[model samples]
Target: MAVTQQEIENRLWDAADELRVAMPEAQYSSVIFPLMFWKYLSDTWEHNHQTFLKENEALGLSAEEAHEVEYSTYQTFKIPFIHPGTVAERRASWSSILATVTQPGLGQRVRASLQAIETANPDKFSRLFGSMAWASEEVLSGEVLAAVMQAMDRTPKMHEGNMSHDVLGGAYEYLLKRFSDGSGTRAGQFFTPREVVELLVEILEPKSFESVYDPTCGSGGMLIASASLLKAHGGRGYTLKLYGQEAVPDTAGVARMNLFMHNLTQFKVEVGDTLKDPRFTKSDGSVKQFDVILANPPYSLKWKPWSNDPRALGGIAPQSSADWAFVQHMIASMDPKKGRAGVVLPHGVLFRGQEASIRRRVVNDDLLEAVISLPPNLFYNTSIPTVILVFRAPGTKVPDRQDGVLFVDASKNFIKAKNRNIITDANVSDIVAACHLKMDAGDESADPTEANSLSSRFVPTTEIAANEYDLNIGRYIKQAAAEQEDLGTLIDAYNIARAERQKTEQRMNALLAAAGIEGFDE
Candidate 1:
């Protein structure tokens, strides 16, 4: 019987369910992902080892020599065989570790095996398992660990012949989505909604061999989305060099795992605060620019980098909000000739009083390409409205939007999914098409009527200046007028109301005279 992709996912979720009883929902990924990845490595290594033995049996090579050749041919990760003093105590691969899941000190042995793998493959797997704290009995009991391992083992082995890359990658992505959904507000910290990521990648349209980066990559979804887009267009997605910097260690580890599981080897994800200690820099100490930059930074964060390594292109963002600070860093890091960026930020950044100066400088430089207003409640964290700011380097060829900016009023476009809203595939396609049309049109004076028909319009820089550089979509895109009433009918109704009032006043005066109230009658 063949194992289906759906069956694989169901089994993985069942394994995750075992953790739910012993750990918080947010910690599920830390434990489950590492274990699943370990199993994958173990299965692949065993498959290769068996093939090497069968083929090299007549080559007169020792087992040790053949194993060395097999290790050299392994593509993804390298796991070494254990060389214990006694054969009875020997433990080599992931299978050796799984054999002890039923032992007395299961947590300690599992942790030791993970540490050994990391130590053996320092270059590739250094700290790759993250600080999962899996060995601590206080964290996860031996009984729960054994049950979880049993559940995972029941699934089809993720070996080279048994599982394809696409199936495995899709299953990993499904687990990520499930974890994000269960994580609540914490999901927003490391996960960008898939539809939103696809929309940004589509707008950027990364080509073959082009470089793509995200300064604050959360679980590396945006980077993967770019490669997937290339693959969808019949290009070799693996050729693209992906780079990212994440502030959190655990999130960075997750990002690394995500890329590796997707079969993306040409990538680098550094761990550090991008604003304070940027990892990617040129020989001259300036930021190394990329072809396409995409990011969804933490909104309105307060940081103290202004005193040390401030990014003061437009103006220093107040310590209360680092939104403009991130924008400035991205702009400075863009490739001078072909660089472009798409960033997701709170809508307040467009018109906030504190960021007015930064907004003015960015607009005046003609780098601001478009401002897209997205639907509110689309994120898991908060219900505040958000916007996607598209930018092109000053020297780039953005004809239609060179002297103006495109405003897209997509605030009302979303599909309600339970408590949250989502931008569907149709919505993403429509938005991306509208952006391309505005870019190709290039006419600042294009008829607003035709432009407004699609919920988007081009606003000249002069008009934006007149409004004091307010990039709010509502300020530029006018709503249609309400239906009007018939003029004659309104006038007739007014006259009838006045006549009725006059007749009532006459009756009241008559009653007042009869009551001998002279002043009232007057």
Candidate 2:
């Protein structure tokens, strides 16, 4: 029987439990991700390697013949499964290292295998293992490492026969989410909530064969969501070209692992500072545009100001915040003919004094398309309100709406969570539908009233100019979320608050009990 996706996720999370005593919850990702990836490569290679031998066994092929087949037939295969060193040699592959769990210097053995695997497949696994040196006794204890391997070993076989790519990919996402939940604010560096990613991808609507890019692609969630959206629409997701750049080297590895888990081979996730040294650029040092671009970039990060870069179309952003700088880079990266972009930024960008000139230039050029004010507390990093700023190639759709920008005040459209708010599927649909009405007003016969809902409206650019180009939601939309809080919603909010309080009390009681004090009653 095939391994169910949920079962695989459960087992993986249990394996993560083995690391609780080994390191802090925030640091589990560095250890867990690499271990999971290693196991995947080893299991898949061993299964395929044996299958290749069996397929040719009718001719009574020898072991050497099978090794040749691994090269000649499976050369183009995504998994570069160079036969691992045997148990005696104690070299590359997960199984070889797992076998030495009882031996001394086990961590060193695991490190050697990782190095060997990277060395064997330079193109695919070049820096895929990343710079983390945690596979050592000095970092992660031998007993904990062994326990983790044993726990993972007991899970369903990771071969294609037992686990499909969808299940594998789902498991990877599950692990990412688990890591994110435990890591707190640090999680925002590599993980964006899936709903936020889905919202951005839906607005972009990337078609098959189109190129999609995320400049500050953390864990490649946005890129993965784009492919998933295509697949959901009965299209071939792997057909779309995916590109991204992550600042952290290990985080880039995680993104690469994520794309591969989804069986999306048509991707290139380079590691580097997107502003200082963008990896994907033309030979002339100009930004290479893509068909669709969306990102949830680092919020208001301080960086050395660069006034001379050609991508800085309007002017230099102050050293305080590089939010507009990322927007400028996206502008330079949008294709002149058919490109469109949606970026998640702090709402302050709508009227911040420092970025006023850049915002004014972008709006005057008719590049700004829509401003969506999302619910607060949607991100793990910060609770500050944010917006999705939509942009298009200057001439693509301005003639349709006579230079107008769509404003959506979805600030109150969310389902409450234990710690933060969540954008429900219904909310996402409502927001996306409103955004499309304005964009398709000229091309499609959109309802007149549909475009001017209580929560959203298409504002003329002149009105925005008169208001000093302040795209604040309160300025245009009469009511936020456009729906009164009902009794059911109020009840749900109360229940969520109660649940959070209960959890806090439980934690406090447990700590008190550990110190031999009386505990709180339920």
Candidate 3:
């Protein structure tokens, strides 16, 4: 009996939802997910230990012979079976055990195992785990914690070679979705709606063996999408390297547990301010470049002391909004050799002259790839319209594309769901297809009116330069073509409005007459 993806997702969400009854959505993610991850690891630990012992004994090896295999096989932080200290041996001392486990001195041992997982599971292992505040007396004393633990124990078992990664991954995604739905605007910070994520990944088409990175990887959804995209394209034989930087430790730890559950132990997601303190620096203390960069960074976040840092490659993102800073960082991290990137940005970033220098530099340098306007309500936080900007180094994968940028006016492309706009598979395909034709100048298709068709055209550098490098999609994509508009639509709208106005006027006249007051329309 195999667990379906839908089943796993629902079960995981149910568990998280139960815990939510006792705590805030945000607070309980820290509490419930770590407990769930712990249960998963413990189950995996027991299962592996039994298998390792059996295999070794059949080969005539002593019980000790299987210890290394037992401890070193999976890409998760290996918790010592016997507590290194008395605290681990007593269930009553769970709090103290957690304290000892997370202490700086003892934490090093955990980090060692983490590093090993990072090396072994490049796609899944690079996140922080067992680093939350779970051992606190508050979590230990609550019945909710007991419920959470029980829920976790019942969670289906998963492993590197087993169904755990996908099972737990689905659960994790479901929980994030539930959080976003419940917390509203606050949850928006870390969540890029799943449909939007799917669209981004579809357009980006991350390949196997390529390194993908997200500077603000909240909850690892984008990273997970990247991995999933590659896996879908083909099995994960190709080396996929993931690098992410997050400012929040708890969020970073959640990302780690996410990767661990998904069996992606090889990624390196660091916790630090991406702009102020970039943790992805190389040995020479410079930014390391990657093949593909996809990010939905906090839109228009501000940072103080607006003075320029040389690290700000795209020019300084305004202190009022760190959007440009993230842009610069993404550009910096991209390897000019084969670098490409796509970013979700506020519509303001397309034409706002407040950061003229940054915009000018990016467009003038011809790194601007494509700008696709998305429908409003696509995000949980804001109702403002958004866009995706694609970039590629000159003479890279698409050489002809280096001189021009693609503009896609997809603002009208979406499926309306209850309270939000969603980018369906069709929308994703439209956007991705438009992007793939990077060399075509705004005329990728002969007919723009065809449904399910991608209408994209390249914008010449000369035109871009003429507009002073404005990246607005409306500036390029012909939203309404000659045949798109019709006399029927115009006549119908005029007739309907005229009829409504006439009725309103007549009703108003009657009301005035009844009140013995005359009203005149000039």
Candidate 4:
């Protein structure tokens, strides 16, 4: 039977359930993702081996030679085993591991298999499984490990015939969501909510064959969103070259796994602090820029990388808040001709005092194109309101609204989810439409109210300069007043308060009379 997305999810969730007793929810991915990926590779290898044997048999090729050639030709990832040896010696695949669940030292065997796979594919899979301490009997008992492995084995077989890359990738994303939800703030280190990702990607509009980059690409969601956006626009998403730099090694591995699961091959995810040691550079050792940059970096991060290697433009961001430092890096990393970026940052970056100089310089350079304030509590890690700052390359052509920065007060546009708020499809579409129209208009002198139905307006550079280059959306877009219908309720409350005050006054007069204070009584 063909495997469906729902079935894949059900199997994955069941496997996750088995791990609940053995480990914390956050640690589940360390064991589950690697094992799931291993099974996928093994299943794919087996399928290719059968196909190659059938096709090459007519060409007088032996089964072993056919298997070898097929392995080299068809597999997206190579799973190493004792080739040309007895079947028992080649017992390193996922199927073999599943068969040995009842055996002693199951955790050690699993760890060894993972190590062997990493050894065989160093560039792609080195330390990819991360540190799985739970894979030890001291941490997770053998019985629990056996039960988890059995549950994973029962999952519907994942192979090309039954599952396409889209379905499998979707399942992988679903698992990522589940893990992030269960892990809470720690999950924010690697995952950005999908709705925000979609909004940024839509506004940036990455094209086919263009390079897209994210400096703090938690779990590679932003990069994947760009690819998915391209695919949605009738372009080949795989053709785009994706680049990402993550500060955490485990998060970087998760990002690489994310891209691989989505069948994205043309990508690089390096482990390093983007501020201190940028991994992507050109032949000249200068920062390599991308056509489209999307990032939701750690908000208000404090770092001193500038003291070691200062960026060329925009003075050093204060050590107290590295928000402007990241902005400078992004601006410097933009393609000189057509580079564009959409970065999510805390509201403080818009009007904070410490970052005034950097903000002024960036604004004077005309790189900042728009500021869209997002709803508060949209993130798992923090309830602070955030904003998306859109920037274009210095020399890039500004269409209609080039005279000033577009301010969008979309802070009220979100659906209340169980815990975190979400920007719905309509909200995303509305924001994107407003930005496009305002940019095309390019008329800061035009009536702000005429710009859009939403509370979006174009604030001229002159006004921004007068206001000390503050990009706070609220400074420009006025909040709507109370509705006429609400006035009735307000009037009723006022009348009730007056009646209570009158009654209190009468009682006070009575008390004054009883106390023989006639002069005080009205």
lDDT of each: 0.81, 0.81, 0.68, 0.80
Query: For candidate 3, which ten residues in a row score worst on lDDT?
Result: 90-99
Task: Estimate the TM-score of every prediction.
Answer: 0.87, 0.87, 0.78, 0.86
Q: Tell me the deviation in Å of residue 145 in model 1.
A: 1.2
Candidate 4 lDDT, 187-266, residue by residue in tens: 76677899999999999999999999999987899999999989998988988999999988777878888888898989
Output candidate 3 Cα RMSD: 9.9
- Look at candidate 4 and give me any clashing residue pairs: 400-442, 401-442
Give the Å error, residue 92, model 2.
1.3
Point out where model 1 deviates above 4 Å.
74-76, 81-83, 86-89, 308-310, 439-454, 480-522
Please write out the lDDT profile of model 3 over residues 100-155, one tens digit for every residue: 44233333332343334344445543444535355444444335544554455455
Of models 3 and 4, which has the larger TM-score? Answer: 4
Kindly report which residue pairs in candidate 1 clash with one another.
400-442
Q: Residue-wise lDDT of candidate 2 within 1-522, one digit each (tens)? A: 878888888888888899888788878888788888888888888787777767776887677876677778854333432334653574367786788799887777777777777777777877887775888788988899999989988878887788899999999999888877777877667888999999999988999999999999988999999999999988878899999999999899899988988888999999989999889898888889999999999988999989589888678988989999999889888899999999999977876666778878888888998888888898877888799999998798646555878887777678889878998888788888877664432222223364333266777778888877766666665564234333234545787899999899988998989998883575
Please give the lDDT score for candidate 1.
Answer: 0.81
Question: What's model 4's lDDT at 380?
Answer: 76
